[model samples]
Target: MPRLNETDRCRAVGMIEAGVRHTDVAIQFGVHRNTVDALCRRYQQFGTTRDRPRSGRPRITSNRQDTYIRVVHLRERLRTATLTARNIPGLRRISPRTVRNRLRERGIRPRRPAIRPVLQQRHRVARFA
Candidate 1:
């Protein structure tokens, strides 16, 4: 199951604070009792339902740059990643593969569409046969 969102987390914490039993809260939220316990503990410690800062190398592209990338690709859906990479002013230094990666993150994939002749009524009858 997916992790609970902020609303669900806050609701769970509220119920726990209202003197609801941990197991009962868990049942009501459809989560394990330990999950409820941990959420309460986190609330007590941090006093916030937001996630902690994650450790890793930061992204190469800013939100604006990513938006530019998406827009450029959307404008020319059939454009190759190599061409798209050259098109973006800020992303020109990055690899075409990186451009493709960003596009993939936004659920855009470039593929050679299937090539088939359009079917007429005779072709449809032949398929049924």
Candidate 2:
């Protein structure tokens, strides 16, 4: 589920400030009572209901790196994502699946080459004759 937006947060806070019960506020918003309680607690503690900056792992690739991947894939359309991931400078550490996902984000899909049977010289000669 998506997080509540600023408008919704403000409205909920307003209802709380206007003497509405937390349960009532939750019912009105169609959210859980705990959600309302948390929002009110956040308002009381931080003086704002806005979302705080969350800490997590930062991105390994930047905009430039993403563009480089896109361009390389465009230049060599037939190359597998594994090969591209292996050959690109500074991208050797990323897995092939990650590379494929990045390309998918940019609307590029690396397809495997179609398989065809190898024809012997006798078969070729027979077909030509």
Among the numbered candidates, top lDDT falls to 2
**Clash count per candidate:** 0, 0
| Structure candidate 2, residue pairs in collision | none
* Residue lDDT tens for model 2, 33-119: 899899999999999989999899777777777887899889989888888777667733777887888899989988766779988
Candidate 2 lowest-lDDT run of ten: 120-129
TM-score (all chains, Cα) for each model? 0.58, 0.73
Deviation (Å) of 37 in candidate 2: 0.8
Count of clashes in candidate 1: 0
Candidate 1 lowest-lDDT run of ten: 120-129
For all candidates in order, the CA lDDT equals 0.81, 0.84
Q: Which stretches of candidate 1 lie over 4 Å from their true place?
A: 63-76, 86-97, 104-129
Clashing pairs in 1: none
The superposed Cα distance between candidate 2 and the true structure at residue 6, in angstroms, equals 1.6
True-vs-predicted CA distance for residue 40, candidate 1, Å: 0.8
CA lDDT for candidate 2: 0.84
